[model samples]
Target: MAERSDFSFLDEAEATCRLAMDPAATGIDLCLILERDALLPAVESIDAAGFFIEDVAVLDVAEGYQARYHFRRFDTKGRIELRVTAPHDDPHIPSIANIFQGAEWHERESMDFYGVTFDGNPNPARLLLPEDATIKPLEKDEKSRKSYLDLMPEFTIVECAEGHPIEELAAKRQAEREEAERKAAEEAKKAEEEAKKAAEEEAAKQSEEAGEAG
Candidate 1:
């Protein structure tokens, strides 16, 4: 796990998670899940550490809307995701556009999709969605998100291992294949036995006919 020397200023906030660094794949090293109030302080520390805001995205989960602030440094390799959850009733958080100009567009897009109000976002214009659309399509569980199979091919998160969520659908598929092979082998053995019985009966009848003729 790559340590963030700058995070010490945040007073050991409990929501931090250390993920193994994978620069080649995703380039993410750390994930800090923070409350709305801790958002500014955490980002301040990140900025001091020389990280720049990459993008801001929003996701609607069972708990509420999740605002994800993606950050990375040009001089450094790994990326960090700073996440904050807002209640379903009132999803809002302070905007970081003032700190990083790139966050301005991202915040607007997130607000457009998930109805997360960025408190100080300057424009807050609808980037992609229709202006008249009142419903946040992303917030509706069925509308915007795809199933696990669609996203990961065939994996479902059933448990966790070594601090990562483990998908067990592959194991379930292997069991199904084993069961099918077992049934096929049993049927083949049964057919072989029936053929042997028929051959033996034929031999016995032929011998009885020969003896009667003699």
Candidate 2:
């Protein structure tokens, strides 16, 4: 269980996109769903916090192309995930290679597999696929794609400083989960009461029969 204040450096970054998540559930302490423009400042703040960039990954979903940046610190117990989405038609995200040089190859790998453009990358060349390849082999078709929220159902957005587009959806999903749990509990209590009543009736019947026989 990590608090927002645990990562104080985020105050200098985008606080509105900050989310405190359950580390036990997601294996991530904090998550930030940042806009394209806010990505660089967030990364800079993480670096200032003594966190190193572990990996940069891209996911093709119904919403768009999601770029995930994983960060971790040796002395800390928490891991942070920074997410930025780009439209499917315009899959362009600002490159973090300038801040973390190691991110250059990771971003290039993403470009090769998902056709994502890492703008400002010193060298935007394919790492795995052929240079002449035009198709992104890892991209999913429209029918097979899943929304970002759908894939990350375990993440509950507890706080949002500024209203975000996905805040409403997260709230709705949380409400639905609570309602389902409430209904299941009610059903269990009702079943228990019914079973208790049936047992009482059976005992009364047997006692009356025994009294009449005596």
Candidate 3:
């Protein structure tokens, strides 16, 4: 039988949510719910505790997107889940790419399919979607979406120790998202221009060939 993990330290650290371990039901040792800003720090804590990143997964819920990070310890027989939700309008989370190099592709795949932005990821380009795909294939319909705030309104949102408003962080993230959009637009424009140039050149070559035949 797998031993139950001692996750009391997370409670002391003031985690947003501390669900007891149920390896049988959840197939994991612990579940720690973290506020957006606290995610990076909590992940660093877990890394320091000798856990390795297993996979980054996301779910499209009514409230928004839930980002679930699975971690496991190779030396020990233990695993844990770190989960956080991002609002649909501004679905952004700090990327763990720096901590786990393999997370780059995982984050990209999530971004391509769910439109969730993993902030701080060195490369945020589409991983699986066609260059022209604007819609996230995995996004849920409006009628089915659930409100994450409604689901857990009682939980306190963690803020910076300096008392920075969550709104400020949200705004900063929104700005980053806007910047990424602008860059994508520019790249798209460049591609269009190149395509037009190529088409014109091909047409001219065809015309020259016809003239030679005449």
Candidate 4:
């Protein structure tokens, strides 16, 4: 387990994750945004650092304003995430992808529906909304907003290990363990066969001597 750091610096957002720094910064505060499967361990990792969870916050949308969850995190040094929400009518949040390069997709997503803009993002292209698709699907009324999280299937939270992707590491470990076990079983079988052959030879020699004496 990694040791926790002092996270008192980030209480402004409701549920922000103080992402551990990449090569770019010594440290940074990331405002997290949640889609469907983007929570899980990443959420817990941020929460373990002592961030607050705010179920409500205000967003500055170009068309108008809206209310949504706004969480905050702070005092972290590496890959971290902050989750925020906006209203069904114009869902939008400030993009921190510039501060944390990984925020590009999240900012793009915010733009897809809420039409929010990241102040200085290089590529705020469509994310969830596909190219040339004529549907702002997430734009919602009160009833539709209730099941936004549930409706989205691609919400699996993936940890961004700048040095190592968790998926590859896990597969490697599993393969090593299996290989070791297979070798051990083969050695044991070979030893057992040698012992059995030796015992059979000894029994045959003794019987031949007894028959000659009789």
Candidate 5:
């Protein structure tokens, strides 16, 4: 039978300590960090196992995927992390922000920066970006195209600037308009000169006709 030990929440430094305790934990390993959407399922798994889960956060990756949900609990003398792998395309998991208030900003930050949609988050907007600002919708294709309507309407919005931002796009269009106007002006000036020349020739021909008739 498994041992029954009390569990505690791990602090930031303690989390690092737990990582150092493990040799196979490469690059600051903290066991498994589940996605926010998978938080409930993960806790259910642990609860079913009779294990305790304490805290949760959005795993921060410097260069790789960041939408990964990271949760942990302090076991006997060590910390065990809870993690889940979200689907690559349309990758979304359940949100546990309801259970843990701390997950609010963590989930918001993840959705804001990484662009992952949480199912039951209180606020899922880009917390880092300005409220009205829209730079990184966080849900763009590989090429940065905004098509992220995958998140539900009721879920919290953690605004990352503003999604579908067209400020730069509008500027580009303005520049194009100015260029077209300049071209049109040039064409009009040329046409005016040609018309003036035709009028002068017509007047000269009329004078010659009058001289001949006289």
Candidate 6:
């Protein structure tokens, strides 16, 4: 069997989301808990790292609506899940259709079934339900709904440490990304200069050979 991909990188990606749980109990490789505002950046990072969306699912829980995005890489043997929750009264999560075109259909299907609104979805029309349908057949009654945390006991929900709010984490992450970009640019420039020098040296050596031949 192929070795499982290491997800220690997610610990460094705390800017995208809180690295909440070990997915061993959850049957996945990694589970990331994201706030609504961090969803796009997290997904963007996932996409940049070569993972593709496997599916987008919504759960109607007592805490509210839980949006779960499953991601997997073609070259890897592990799965990563992104979880975000919206209040029951406000079941709105940002749509990732712009980042992953395939998510448009999945979001529409969730809208039809669970009444979860995927904000910014290009086409939010019903996918399987009738155009005039208003009732979301999959929405459970309050009594029937389960607590989000209860369903996912593996998640470690802890209060943010003093002076390290989500906003601060996000800002730090941005700075780190900018620094990485700057270093990459510098490296590329250095490589280009070295290549030019090598080319010039080759040309000088060829000219010397030609002069000797003459």
> What are the per-residue Cα lDDT tens digits for candidate 4 across 90-195?
4444544444455566556656655655546678667777777665545554433433232221222234334432334445556877999999999999899999
lDDT of 2 by residue, 75-155 (tens): 668888999999999999999999999999999999999999999999897899889999888999999999887777366
Top candidate (TM-score) = 2
Query: What TM-score does model 4 achieve against the real structure?
Result: 0.33
lDDT of 3 by residue, 1-214 (tens): 5454444455554455554455665677666667789888888777777778889998888757899899887666667778888988899989999988878999999999999999999988889998778999889898877654333312223332343333344456668889999999999999999999999999999999999999
Please list the residue runs of candidate 4 whose C-alpha ends up more than 4 Å from where it truly belongs after superposition.
Answer: 11-83, 88-90, 113-119, 128-130, 147-214
Query: lDDT tens digits, residues 33-120, model 1?
Result: 6679878878877887788887888777655777878887666456777778788788889998888888998988888888889998
lDDT of 6 by residue, 28-79 (tens): 7667777798789878888887888999989998878889999887776788
**Ranking of predictions according to lDDT:** 2, 6, 3, 1, 5, 4
Question: What CA RMSD would you report for each candidate?
Answer: 8.6, 2.7, 21.8, 14.0, 20.7, 19.3
- lDDT (CA) for every model shown? 0.69, 0.86, 0.76, 0.47, 0.49, 0.79
Cα deviation at 52, candidate 2, in Å, is 0.6
Backbone collisions counted per model: 0, 0, 5, 21, 26, 0
Candidate 2 lDDT at 191 equals 100
Q: Which residue pairs overlap in candidate 2's backbone? A: none
Deviation (Å) of 98 in candidate 5: 1.2
lDDT of 5 by residue, 122-210 (tens): 88776887767655444445554322222111111112123322233334556888999999999999999999999999999999999
TM-score of each: 0.59, 0.90, 0.64, 0.33, 0.39, 0.67
- Give the worst 10-residue stretch by lDDT in candidate 2: 1-10
